[model samples]
Target: MLKTVSGTGLDNLWDDAKASGMTESDKLLYRSNLLGSDKRVTNYGGGNTSAKVMETDPLTGAEVEVLWVKGSGGDIGTIDKSGFATLYMEKLEALKGLYRGPEHEDEMVGYLPHCTYDLNPRAASIDTPLHAYVPKKHVDHVHPDAIIAIAASTNSKELTQKIFGDEIGWLPWKKPGYELGLWLEDFCRKNPEAKGVVLESHGLFTWADDAKECYELTLDTINRAIAWFEEQTEGVAPFGGAAHPTLPEAERRRVAAALMPAIRGMISEDSHKVGHFDDQDAVLDFVGATDMPRLAALGTSCPDHFLRTKIRPLVVDFDPANPDIDGTLDRLRGMIEDYRADYAAYYERCKHDDSPAMRDPNAVVYLVPGVGMITFAKDKATARISGEFYVNAINVMRGSDAVSEYQGLPEQEAFDIEYWLLEEAKLQRMPKPKSLAGRIAIVTGGAGGIGMATAERYLSEGACAVLADIDAEALGKAKEALVQRYGRDMVRSVEMNVTSEEAVAAAYADMAVEFGGVDIVVSNAGIASSAKVEDTTLELWNKNMSILSTGYFLVAREAFRVLKAQGIGGSMVFVASKNGLAASPGASAYCTAKASEIHLARCLALEGAPEGIRVNVVNPDAVLRGSKIWTGEWLDQRAATYGTDKEGLEEMYRDRSLLKRSVLPEDIAEACYFFAADTSAKSTGNILNVDAGNVQAFTR
Candidate 1:
């Protein structure tokens, strides 16, 4: 039943191909989308598609045959022509004659760029040559969980014969390179009737002259594997189960909500690195199975999975009722160390003198029974992507074991693929991530307005954004909104009263658990108050000072403590106000507290400079839209002071500024980003005004 996504109907597939105004690259995009749409076929960036098309070269203005293959930047489902890595097929083929063996492997990288007919910035996929070697005009190479389920099993040879018979050729594990191309080239010559080549412990390479047939070959092969799995496992429990039973869904989430942050803390090696906990059904089922420890030890679903997931998942046991967090966390730390030691031993066993230095011996995933599995990496982006890839692996391994024993590739084979030059080329093609890519940042009062904007900016620039506020309801709503846009991994929410030292400590501890450490802290939480000095009551004055002045001090103190503990220098931005630089009448409480907060930033900056922590302040005024302080009675009161209605006052305030523009939360966010990112590496003890050019509050 597995098939292409609903697009380009089969009956008209050739009709459209024959009578299409769409460019070849556009047609390939359409086909790639169809292939990538089904998660069963390819999830995330797991596949490559290509078309042999003739195009006028931009450089030489001559028509040339190029293989336009989907490269980096997206999964098959969402790729555009821009995702296609256009290469001259003739030039790509010319290098095939020069290959003697695997020695020319690394040199393939140097040759790819020169062979690229178009100077597209995106590098060709590591499997470019595999596409080039085949005689077909179109190719669909994807890792369908169903196909991998068969190919990754101990009985792979038997299953391969059962499913495809003489129609599909089989190759033992070979890392994608010049070597793989040679193997495929020779096999195609001998097995001319084959529809595809099943790469053992790898994936599928299916091709046809037409795009539709190539896609059908991939789907049809996977369907055959699925059919075999269905017929063989008629009465068998999904996989060997003791771990199959699960805690109540609610209880499981409760355990994850508590345990994941702690696990994240235990495994994190640096302030920039973080953890992502995934409790999807497949992950939970696999981790909860009784024989999970033994089954998981088999290894990654494939060699390429090792690039992100490492060789094997680290398994742990947990009691949902007595999740003895602190003790359990300590145990996790020891387990991670053991995992590292074991990896080093494995490296010692297989390592050659010329091998690249082993990647850090750390667990990318932890299979916990009650809490599901948690994936760790340097940043939220990597953590989530790795998380998805691991989920696919879990399904493949489970299906493989159900069919036969799960026989993973040897550890040395994984090492070869892990250190292959093509993966190095992929790494080389990766653009430098943003300065805050790995930093964990928290914005206090980030439920809405300037704080929320600042949190969003941090997430976009690759920092983990934790929204901290005193309002739990608001925090929950904000978390939902962010997760809808950025995913659950990059954003977190915690409720805290910044003025209460106990609350502040608890908040900081929560941060420690979630991200191992905190690097950038935005002290944005504050309460706005307006009254003449004589008219303000003692309680009102205390309240304003507690939130604006004392709150800033507490958050800054905790940030310093957390950063010092981690031994990683960080950045802190205090969201002061224009009133801090110039006082306003009938607003003594708000003005004075803000003034104190600015000075607090300067003092912190002076203290933090020696340790490389930068502290800066942004004076944001009249950012009335989306602000909790600017609504209802407060809005009426502020507008009354200007003798105008709310809308009139907004315009009046905007018109009065030197630039005659209203300050927005995003404007303040831009300044906060400057301080939070390394853009201000040399800047500290600084103040940037975000009040639309208010000269009266300008500071030298």
Candidate 2:
């Protein structure tokens, strides 16, 4: 029986009781999840798992073999049964007759749908043939770093023989497709006694007649490789003994914060990009190494790593001995331009007659010594994942360099895989990006009802948000809810008192590091009061002004500075109130401060117009539901001043509006969304009344 201890090197998680009632397909999923759960086994979405199981044919009452394989673009770690593409095993075998040669292999992907079993809609991956042709009941193809390190070494085949002997074989490099599938089949036929084979500069492939055996063999193969590398390279200095020292954690983060936004701006000419910062020990070791530049320039060997991280990463010009941020920033634009030119040249040299058009030429991964690794992508998750893949590449390089000379995939081969027509089709099939896609937002008072709603709305539309609020407890709850709905990649939180200039500036700096830079700013931190002119104390008057009026200024001022630094014109939405435009009786302090917010936005709009920054205002009235202010003394004071109970106040406000409709937090959120979105790009310096038709507050 295999031990089932956690954190003790890939524990076999299969249980007899758990597997007792599971079908073959269920066992396959269980096995795949276990293997995928560990990065030591496979990187995310860098593997394929398959099982050939007998199933009753839908049309005929006879049993037929069905090949269930993980679908294209699905991660093994998170895949469900639906994520598997089921194809008829007999039909998949028949595709061998249609294959003309290696030149027409991509066309085989189109034929996979015709072999679908039981009308499964999940699209079969390009690797379907690799699994189908392997003559085994179950197969696992994983790009474990431990295995790839051996595969990417200069003496890969000899090392494979030395490490696993006859149990595992090695195949020469070939791009994955129908032709490579045939190679795998032929190799297996000649080496029937072998449990697996390592594809040169690719990954590991292990198979067995039983699902559990196949899973265990894969684990055993990887574990052997891991143990071999540890023994062979024990105490050997990695990457030439790390040429530079890593900066202190705090200093590293501060450097990342300074550099990320500037790099984001330079690369965002085509479209805005989000960023991810990784300063893991592995990354630090690689970026600070003497061999980092040489290995990075050679690029990644595995197709999975190459595809996600691009051909190579850009090494920033920063010396850890003498940190010069300004000098780095000054040279940044030239470095980026040179990368683009080199990429365009690569595309020109490698383009086939039918290759897809060159993609965004900017490097996905950026390495800064002493700082960390920064990755910019179309979204936060992609940015972070790109960083993770590069780290995997770093590990592979470390092992291979210590043992034998590390070798990346030849440039033409890497380009062919990157620009493959099948891969291009998959990219083209992706759904259109949302309106606010790639944009980053910072919402003040983000723990409150309207603020949370606005953050959710932004996140739903594909914008990453930094939730800022003075109340840490409420901020935590708000972040948890948003992270649950939109994912942690899209939501970040910071405790901020908008009244303090230092806090506001620090929040923006944090935002810059967390998500590149800000594209939208929602100034919604507020307070409410209903004191008469005679009853209003100096303290009460100043409190209202400090929060409502001064807070908006501080937040907007910081936003302007960051936006200017990014050189990407941004949007600022101030959540003022109906009292800003229409005077309210017995609310002298509150109304005055609200009025100040409106004029400030107007002035900002004028100053920001030349720089393409737009300033707008959202006026919400009597938003009682879920409002933090409404749950406290303000609700009672407003109810008493209006001669109605708290419950009756909402109804009274609703009846008083021209539309006679009550406004909720969502209603205000929608108006804020409009100003933040490009829909209001031409309509800045505008006040959008979300008060359900209050004529007194109408902008017209």
TM-score of each: 0.80, 0.98
- When summed lDDT is taken over every stretch of 10 residues in candidate 1, the lowest stretch is 4-13
The residue ranges of model 1 lying beyond 4 angstroms of the native Cα positions read 1-24, 54-65, 72-74, 118-122, 243-245, 257-259, 262-271, 320-322, 447-449, 467-519, 532-585, 588-700
lDDT of each: 0.79, 0.91
lDDT per residue for candidate 2 within 1-700, as digits (tens), equals 2132212356677788887889999999998888888777777788999999999999998999999999999988888999999999999999999999988888888899999999999999999999999999999999988889999999999999999999999999999999999999999999999999999999999999998899889988988888888888878889998788789998888888888888888899888899999988888988999998999999999999989999999999999889988899899999999999999999999999989999999999999997889999999999988888888899899999999999999999999999988888889999999999999999999999999999999999999999999999999999999898989899999999989989988898888888988999999998898888999999999999999999999999988888887887999999999999999889999999999999999999999999899999999998998789999899999899889998899999999999999999999999999999988889889999999888888778
Q: How high is the lDDT of residue 320 in model 2?
A: 86
lDDT of 1 by residue, 400-490 (tens): 8887888777887887777664565566667887777778898999897988999998888888888999889988988888888888778
Clashes of 2: 0
